[model samples]
Every structure is written in C-alpha cells, then in structure tokens.
Target: MIQRSTRFGHLLRSFRDAPSSSSSKIGGYLLASTASSPLKQACVSTNRDDEFANLDWDNLGFGMVPTDYMYIMKCSKGESFEHGQLSNFGNIELSPASGVLNYGQGAYEGTKAYKKEDGRLLLFRPDQNAIRLKNSAERMCMPSPSIDQFVDALKQTVLANKRWVPPPGKGSLYIRPLIMGSGEILGLGAAPEYTFLIYVSPVGNYFKEGLAPLNLYVEEEFDRASRGGTGGVKSITNYAPGLKALTRAKNRGFSDVLYLDSTNKKNLEEVSSCNIFVVKGNAISTPATNGTILAGITRKSIIDIARDHGYQVEEGTITVDELIHADEVFCTGTAVGVAPVGSITYQGTRMEFKTGAQTVSQQLYFTLEAIKKGLIEDKKGWIVEIDQ
Candidate 1:
C-alpha cells in the first residue's frame, strides 16, 4: 500500500489520477478542485475551515493533508515582492513559460510549529528558515522576500489556520513556502516575474510507531551532487533525478540511497531527503557543504549541540569505507529528524553497524523536541512563540 507521507512529499505529490472532468467530491474535505489538465499529483481539499479540527491528529502519518486556505505573494522584474494572498486552497495560475517548469528556477523552505505545553503556539527557528529560504531564492536567481515579511507572513498564515495544526504529540502542520519564476518566456533564462506562496497542511509523525534505523544502499553509479551544482539550495529539481535510483534501491529493500560526490564516487554526500553523518570513537563527522550537498538547518544545529555536549565533530568529505567503519551512523533533516543507519551496502558488500543509533542522536532528538515544545531552556533562543 502507498504510504501517506509520500502522498504529497513535495509542494504536492502528483498522483496518476485524471483531473476529474467534473468536480466530483472526494469525501467532504475538498469541495471543488481545479486541477490542471494532465494533473500528475495534487492535495485536493476544501475550505471547510473545520477540517483540521476534526482530523485524527495522533494517527497522522506524514506529509500535510491540505485544508482551507493558502497564502500567495508575487513579484515582477526589478520590482520588490508584492503582498498577495490566495484564500482558496487550490492551484495557482502559472504560465507555460514559467521558470519553475522550464528553467527550474524554484526554491522552497520547510519548518514547523509546535503547541507549547502552555497552550500557546511556538515556531521552531522561523528566522533560520527565512534566511535559508532567502538564500535558496538567491541561488536559484530568484528575489528574496525580506526576513521580517517572511516571518510575519508565516505567523499570520499559521494563526489564520491555527486549528489545522495537529495537537501536540500528534503531528505538526508542515509549512512550505515556494517561490518560482513566473516569467512567461521560452528563452533559456530566468523568469521575468516570480511568485512566492506559502501553504499549510497537518501531517502525522514522520516515523509512525517508533524510530527505526534505515538500511541505506550507497549508490556508486549516481552521484547526488557535483561541484557548482544547485545541491546547496533546496530546489525541487534536485529530487526528480533521484526517483529512478531510489526506486531501484527500494526494490533492493533499502529505505533510501546514499549519494556521493560526482567527481569521485568515493566521498559521501547525503541521502535524497536528508543530510548524513557518521559517529566514530568520540567524534561525529559529515560531509562539508561544498556547493553540492544541502546545507540543512538541522544538520548545522546537530553539530553545535554535539559540540556543546562535549562531543567532537567534523565536517568534510567522508569516504564510504569510513562510514562502514563508523561506530554508529545517522541521518538528519527537518523531516524524519534523525534516522539511525543500521547498515550500508557498497558495491554489493553489505556492512552492518551496531544499532541503537549514536548516543548523541537519542540525546539530540529528545532535546530538540523539548526545546520546540518550550519545556526546556532554549539556549540559542531558537524557538519563536506565536499566539503571544
């Protein structure tokens, strides 16, 4: 059976379902969906407003279940980003010549909010997400929205649909803000116009029952990143190329595939959805963000936390053999948080590492969650409390 998390992994996952010639209702959530012709994937839902309040919060799997409203903003060539909002939860009009589809000038940011134990709302590192998003936009040759405006829009949007957030411990509403080139030209160039939009959806736990370590198939044939590639930025195009490789790895019964440097397949990069790390002796190491690998916010935070807690950490090119020799291995990201790697296969030689993840992984998981829920001291002031 298809898992729920994969339902809308990206801005939305395109399903094979034909665009309903007529708006036939799918349950009571989506009233009318205006999916485009040849609609590959979508999160069809409606503005019932009460949809989120009535969901089975605790049982949510992963990925957002779209609700009523979404926020949209746009910009033109040499013009500052203009405040725009789209209330209805449906598709936006993009010219066939739009850059996101043609030249692939699209970038996005991902972060989450947690319900504080006090019943107020708390956002996990909104400023960080804003900065990363702006950086992503710049990498894709798109304009950046001011940090304050981005945070303000997120706050307003979340509050407007506050009820949609799954109850604490149940799930968190994943917030995705996408900016794409709107320039409707066929030339191999940037979109003259760009559109920035934010959407919210209640999602379930990333790891359903419990955190299970993953079996990663180290891919030697396909490199996940290359010098000067757009891997440093969170671009959608970075993922599509991995689908075939990932499918093959899954067929081999591995949860994910590991990518290495394109120049030399010897160095470790990261998994398709998250950054990677290996624990050896008393030190933790991951590949350096050398233009290719994604600079994951969580990955950076983990490094700091590990150091603060007295664990040595290193960031540079890590070889596949080094990983097989690691005392423990884990992957980090916004989604799935930290997943331990039990074993990795390199050139058909399966290497098994002891389970239970690294000690730091366990410590950081609870510590991060505690900080998010406002139960512990946020030394770096990372948590942003909403709802006052």
Candidate 2:
C-alpha cells in the first residue's frame, strides 16, 4: 500500500502537471483525456473485480461507509480548476480560519452510481449535477471545475471504489462532490484557495422505513430561505439553518419538516432537503425554482417523465391550502427519489393523501429507476456507463 503522505505528494505533483484536453463526450459533457500515467492506473484499472467488500449489503443505511479511494483537486482564487487526482479516502487538512469554516463558502452536490448485474456501473444525469455545481460555485463566489473535469473525476472515483458499490437492487454508491473555500481568512470574504473533492458511500435508502410514505410537519415558525438568498443553490450554509427545524419536527414524531416561503409564509416551498410536488387529477404542480427552492435533478426528470406520459406538469407557486387538498404529494431529490407523502400536518391539522403502488409517485419511481439501471433502453441518453 502506498503511504498516505507519499500518495498526497504524488497527487499534488500530478495536479501541477495535469492537462486541459478532452477526448470524448458522455451524457453531453466532455470527458477529460487520460494517458496511461502511473497515477491514473493507481486510480482505476480497466478490468472489473468480482471480489467485493465485506459489508452487509442487505442492511445498508444512509450513512458514511468509507470506500477505498476518493478524488481531490485544488485551485487558487483567480484561476480556473485545471486538474485533480485520486487518493485514499481520509480526512483532509483545513486551516483553523478557513473561509468555509467561517463564512460558509462551500457548496455540495449529490449523485449516485448503480451496479448492474453484469458488473457494469451506471450514473444517471451526472452532467446535470456538474452544471448545478457550477451554478452553486458561482453563487458562493468560488471557482469551480469545468464540466469535463467534474465528470471525469466522478468517473475515476466511482471506478476506483467499484468494489464498494452495492449489488444491483441492494443499494447504490452515493457520490458526493464538494467545493469549498479552504484558504484561511479572518474577515468575511472568499478564501484565496479552493478545493474540490468527491467521495462515495454505499447507501441503501434515505428513509429508514424503506419507501414507506413520510409524515411531514409544516414549519410555520421558521423560514427555510428568504426570497433573495442562497436558497436556490446548494450552499453548505443553507442546510444548517434547516436542521433546527428538522430536529424539532423529528422530535415531534414527524419524519421531516416542510418549510414555506419566507416572504408570504403561505406558499409551499419544499422540505428540508427535497423538492415537493402536488398532484390533483391529471395536473401535477411543483414550486418554481425562483431563487428560493433548489432545482433538483430528480425533480426535473420526474417532470419530463410525467409529461411524456400524458400528465400536465406545471411549475408555479403552490400554496399551503392547495397542498391540503391534493390527491397525492411526493418529494424528489438524489437522496429521496420519489417518496410519497403520507400526511402533512400544518398548524395542528393533518391532511392525508394517497400512497402505495397505485399512485403517480410509484409509477414515476419505477420509470426513473428502470432508466437509471439500464433495464430499459436509455433513449434519452441519461445513463453514463463508467468504463470498467
């Protein structure tokens, strides 16, 4: 095994001499060119391994289980991110006064890799995550890796940690790509240096109930995001504020907290982490991504799938009263795929909705999963199969 310090030094040297060329495209994003460098070989081999990690695949949960390898890259304030390398998955060094630690100048993205029965791994709409990461970086005043760099690093990390990927239908390797201002700064400004890292964790399901409907509590006292803030972006700071509400709701016997818009407080925005949709008759509506709610990739795909199947999908302001009367409600995100809302309690009144296999959530969930796992032909070209 390579010594940790030696591997880190190797990564730094390779990052210094990395190239800026692309050879091909996958899922509408350019893939960085790769030569047979020893560093690259150390990251991933072209052959798949049948031997797997010793873990309870059937009892996996949505928690961190360290994989074998991770991807890391660095950039200065005024420079574009050029290159990165794979290293052992471990804790990273950060300054005591880092900008991310002080001013919260960080953003993150979540995507997943699914293992196929034939030993192939699949990534669904990774280009979308790359684009969203760029948007978040811009919002947080940090330089970001290009889509090519982002997608390539993701592929390298997943390929290097392929053994940790759960078996098909068991779970998936959760890919988390993060961009943070790691440089030290005492004042409230962006840091001088930034870091982009990707790590993977094999996860079973987001909810412990395993696809059972969620009982959400509407948080009227706390506001998740203001109208003109970083609510639309995946900023690290944006999540911390909602945790208080989430914890309080969980304490009150609810699975999660559904927050409303800060401006009116009557308009439904989203849950703490996922985007929500309300279904009535043939019409499906979700809150618009208007600088207050995240533009979730899973939410976007579900809209397309729903529209293609003759459902009228709309993105607009969905009020709290409308949610109470909806026939069905569901949430979507990378973590919570298409989870039906069993009940929503607002201001001491609870409203129930239709759940189970006959609802729209289940139908869309199956369709999305089918396309993601390559069980169906990827006509939309959303699946990016990693090179074995």
Candidate 3:
C-alpha cells in the first residue's frame, strides 16, 4: 500500500508489471473528449483525414507529415503525472530549462507499420526498437520503460493514430518514441522526472529524390565512432561532429559519406544514418556491431534474407580498399534502406562497382521488401499488429 502515496508514480511503477494476456478482444476504442493537467503543457489534435488523401503521391517527402492524432504523457518533480493519455496530433510545450536542452539527454527510436493488403496493420520488428530505446535510457542514466509498458503504450498510441499509416504500397507510419528530462533546472544532474511522448506521421519514401543509386564519398578525415563511444547507441550527440564531412559530401553532389574507424582510418564503417554492406560474388559483408556501429535492424534483416537466398554473409573489419574492390555496395537503415552505391570516391580516386541489377544485393532488397509488405512468410515472427 506504500506505493499509493505518490499516486501516478505507483501507477507508472505498476505499468511495468502488468499482464498483457489477450484473454479477449475489446470493442472499438474508447475515445477521450478532454482532460485536465497541471504538470506542463500537453495536448493532441487531429486534422481532417481527407487532407492526407489529397497529397500528390509523386511529390511526397520523408519525415512525418501532420497526422490525425498523437499520444502524450508528462511527469514533473514531486507531483503525479497529470497528462498520460492518447490525444490529437499537436505541438507540445516544454520549458527552456528542461534538462534535455542543456545536457543533451534526449533520445529517440524509429520504427514503422505497414498496412497490409488484407487490411491488417503490421509492425515490422517493433520490439527491436523498444529494446534499443531501453538501451538509450540506460546510457543516459534514465529508467528503462519495461518492454510491456513500452509495447502497450505503443499499441494504444498506434491504434489512436492508425489512420495516419498509408494503405498498402502507399507508404508507412513512422513511429517515434522519445524520452526527455522534464524537470526544469539549471544543474548538471539527472532530473528525477521525465516525459515520454510517442508521435506518428504517415511518411512515404525516405529519399524525396527517389530511391535511386547514390554516389558515396569515402571520408577518412572525420570519425563517427570511437572505441568506447555512444556511436553504437543512437544518441543525438554522435551526429553533430560528423556533420562537416557529411555536408561536404552533399555539396559535392554525393548522397552520403563513409565514416572510418576512429583509431585507424583504414577500417570502413557506416555513414551518418545507415549501416554499410557489400556484395562480392556470392559473399555478403557488413561491419560487425562491435560497440562502434549502430546495429541496424535492416542490416540484420538483410543478413537473414541473404542467407535464406543462398549467399554467405560475413561481418567483421571491412577496410576502405575492400569496399573499393567490392562487386556491389549498399546501406541499410529505417530511413535510407538498401541504398545501392555505384561508385566510391575516396580522396581523389574513384572506384566504380558493377552492381549487376540481377545480383544478390537487389535480390535481398526485394526479399526484405516482400516480408515488410506482408507478401512473404514471416519466418522470424517480426510483425506485430498495432491496430485491432
């Protein structure tokens, strides 16, 4: 009974231990009309569903477009959480003194849901993203939201925003789960309170320019990860230092820059947002996730797909010269997935690759796509339904 003293705190704690048995399915969702909150500003809004249908599919871009609804929750120092409910998709309020602003303590994870041809909404590897977010919270000295609470909140949030996901083949709804310190203070200490927010946007292709083959600029001058750095973790701080080289590559008409291992620049690593891969005859290779590169879900999925298609997938230290001589190159992530690289421009020398259109790389891309779109047998049990 002592857990009842702090009200919502106990509720939050109990959420970690709740049973998730689907003894029976409930009826249609129960919608919220309005509620009161005193901790901070929190609200949800919805636009007309017709507004999304009116977009020109040919001109759509990446990132979440404004959607019909969103879910929000707030916590503060020495007070119960006043707003932890699903609502409309709208802007949220945060104080300038929030710990995330000054200490860079905020982190997020990205996952997607595809509405199947038969009308069931499927989440590809949502649990993977949930587990990764827990790692992020641990790295930042925050509590890990139990997988049950995380998944349950996601089920509630995604159901509330299911309409935002495009119909089959149109696109998907990108779900972002974020944790930030909400206790407004100027001290460099872990804030005892935090706010968890989940938002959804019906986004299409990641590259607005289209998923065409891209040219890569090999960057040995800048490093994206160190031996014991947050590079492996999806922390925001790992990005800023790599911006100079990434922007330089973009200025020269390249899609991305390859980051080399920090200790020695010879070891090939991943780009800003995607993990690297190479195809050589029948052998597929990617950098092993040795606490340096972000263990991309797509990268792992590609490995599985490759093995299933009778190819040898290898992961270890891949050098710059190895990539230059690679028969084919590709990168994978939630956003920039299975992006083919035609040539590698390292320093002043350009090495062109022969990525046979009918080769292993293209085949793996299609295989993964088929699984994501619900056209293939889900051997790994990766899909989870967000909407009933």
Per-candidate TM-score against the hidden true structure: 0.84, 0.91, 0.84
In model 3, how large is the Cα lDDT of residue 87?
47
Give candidate 2's root-mean-square deviation (CA, Å).
Answer: 4.8
Model 3 steric clash pairs: 44-88, 45-88, 45-89
| Residue-wise C-alpha lDDT for candidate 1, range 1-388, written one tens digit per residue | 2223321222221211324442333323222233342111123334444524877765777855776667666678678773433354665666676788788888898887777545687888888888888888887888978887787667756765677877778767788888889678697877888877888888765654347778889887777767888889898778889988999998888888999888878888889889998888788999999889888988988888889888899998798878656888888888877777778999888887666634667877777778777878999988887643
lDDT (tens digit, per residue) of candidate 3 on 1-388: 1122343444334432333321111122343322221211222223333423555555557865776555556555444434344544555555677687778777788877778877787878878887988888778766545565566667667666666667778777788888887667688987767887788877777754466777889887778989888888887677888889988999998888888888988888898889988888888889999999998888888888889888999999998888656888888998766777778888788887766578666787888888888898888898776546
Q: Could you arrange the candidates by lDDT from highest to lowest? A: 2, 1, 3
Which structure is stronger by TM-score: 2 or 3? Answer: 2
Record all residue pairs in model 1 with backbone atoms less than 3 Å apart, i.e. clashing.
14-40, 14-41, 15-40, 15-41, 30-45, 30-46, 60-204
Task: For each candidate in turn, give its C-alpha RMSD to the true structure in angstroms.
Answer: 9.2, 4.8, 7.3
Find the 10 residues in a row with the least total lDDT in model 2: 22-31
TM-score of 2: 0.91
Worst 10 residues of 3 by lDDT: 20-29
State model 2's lDDT: 0.86
